[model samples]
Target: MNFFPNFANINECLEWVKRKDLALAKMELICQLLNHPEKKQKTIHIAGTNGKGSTVAFLTSIFQNSGLQVGTFTSPHLDDWNERIKVNGISITNHEFFLISQQIMSELEGKVQPTIFEFLTAVALYYFAEIKPVDLVIYEVGVGGKYDATNVISPLVCGITNIDYDHLNYLGNTLTDIAQKKAGIIKKDIPCFTTETKPQILSLLQKISQEKQSKLCKISPAKKFIFDSSQLITNFCLTAKKHTFNLKTKMLGQHQIKNASLAVNMVLYLQKYFPQITQSSIEKGIKEAFWPSRMELISQEPLIFLDGAHNLGGIKSLIQTLKTFFPAKKPIFLISIMKDKQVDKILNTLKKIACQIIFTEIPETRRQEISKLKHNNTAKFHKITDYSKAFFSFYSLLDNQKIGIICGSLHFTALIKREFLMNLNEKLNNFSLSNHQPV
Candidate 1:
């Protein structure tokens, strides 16, 4: 066994782990050591259990369409670390990633041991401030907002999506506790936006905002957003005040409709600073913007769809979307999950819609073990450790007229995306999928 490949090496900086302690000292220290580069950039901070990534994508598209340079940082990456950092919808190249990591390592030599999240946050903020000239930056909180490494900046506007159950160990056991953690990003005199519909969560956030003297604005869902799969392109009709526009997107799921609304409301809130953003640009951005791995379809024949719905709320939404999109057909479910997730609840939820369930593991360390999995009689549960082989078998069954959906942890979806998407394009009936964005 080998360890510590030299701290000065760029590879050492690439290490990852979910941090404990719920402390920001390491993050604050690194930010100060780097001279607080994050302060130089204007940002919109988003926190929530789900829909944060989709909301970020929508906002990024709107800003880019308005001709403003945009830099975005997100977490729990799909394939590569570079996916976590992007400017104007393009990820950082290998050279830039390595250069910045090495620079951070050099600065932190024997001084302080920052968690992987803190190190990456420092790197992203420094790059956005010093290396790239961007008009705005949009970043998502990695965990709970208060102590998350990315919470260093005082954002121009804070937007929180729906708050649900997740990270119970660190956040809390109740929704109110989780709401408090999410609302930590609300600052004094800053405008805040959210799509949280839960009355308890919303009231808690409202009280927190008032206490901090922050103006909190809640966004309601689009009154007329249409989600008919019969329509080739999914269309969203979002109205802001008196302005109404029709936007089109390939991303399905009712939750996405709410996320788009949150992003649109964020742009509206930012209008006081960046007056160039208009209704037309927002519509165009929504039309051209699509987030990968959230209700994305890869094949048209047997309707092979992949979604990264890991938690109980996300899984419930996934089941609803399935009922909406494919009302006439039942889907064979291919699923994997994380060990820390609500495993029993997740399994019970999937058992409702699945005629056949294939349980497998990804290449990540936090994956749930197959041997530890409980045998279920609800569905034909088949346990397998090799995800790639199981996925191929599922695809083969799909070719024989079986509707299928792959729903599980994002890591497993990322693995399937990196390894099987191209192979799918090669094997399918002379069709290449354009839905998959480069990982």
Candidate 2:
């Protein structure tokens, strides 16, 4: 085994973004060479078109509250690459990431060339299994579950958040086709849970689970929901496995209620293995768990929100949340989407609630051109090549009567979030300095 030539730093590892052919054989071979790190921990595998990250966050917080060591692996990090791997809500340090990468690359000895995600998956498995072992590990599927890099793990429990039309290029376009692909995580006699309620999709999932001899728990939406607009919290009651549990969460939108319910059900199902998780931990965890860039309120004075609603389904949910929370008021939207996404449908959906739209470019090759984002709608549209300039231009127009939302691609939202936080901090610092009198 030899170290990958010229791989000096973590950035070098992060630069391998080219996605290779989607197949499990390569990842299986890599795991075998690494001595089966995937099988060394209690695991829960999650796959879906959306809500995967939120469900993972809810589960992580729940297990942590139970006083168990929990490790989580999620994707499309908002800020740094290390965010993809975490133990007890703490990301892996860059030094640790580099060391692990070096070890895995040396072991492979150039015999196997893994995509960026594959390499990162290997790193996460090794880190959890050998370096920093935990009581349980939760894995989020990178793409469709059938061939996703994370599918190699035989998890104790599996969950599919919901089936929708996403990643149409790789997964099929129809809902049934997509549902089958996501249902791939179900293993023999392992209980699977989902929040998907569509009859057709549920039937397909039921068929697949029956074939695998797995019990598919179909979670219904909350029986009742109450939202506190002033505090931005939701309280709901959910019944699963003939037991009813009351849950509350800070994550906004009607969709999050379903996500939180699914997490609760999965945790309850796993109590046989982890009996330390009590109702108190589940309630506390649901209340405290938070994931950024999903209906996040960055500012309340001018009412600014940032959401990563890139697809049509997500955009529809965003629209619903806007209507429910701020009815009859149109908010200005700042949006940039990936080229591969259904740009027209997403823009059209946003138009339903947007008083104005500012189209900006994300700092990536995959971003749709600002010109293509324009649509003929009543809402005033402006195209700005630079996102910072676009944001400032939009900010100048906001007042108590006007609100703003930054959305579209998660990558774009991440960049804007950093800029917004930095700008806000600067303003606060200046305000404090002006108010101080040498005290």
Best by lDDT: 2
Position 101, candidate 1: lDDT: 85
After superposing candidate 2, which stretches have Cα over 4 Å from the reference? 1-22, 374-379, 425-439
CA lDDT, candidate 1, residue 166: 91
For model 2, what is the C-alpha lDDT against the true structure?
0.86
Q: Which clashing pairs does model 1 show?
A: none
**lDDT: worst 10-residue window of model 1:** 430-439
lDDT of 2 by residue, 374-424 (tens): 564343777778776677766666778877888989998999888765587
lDDT of 2 at 42: 90
Error of 1 at 425 (Å): 6.3
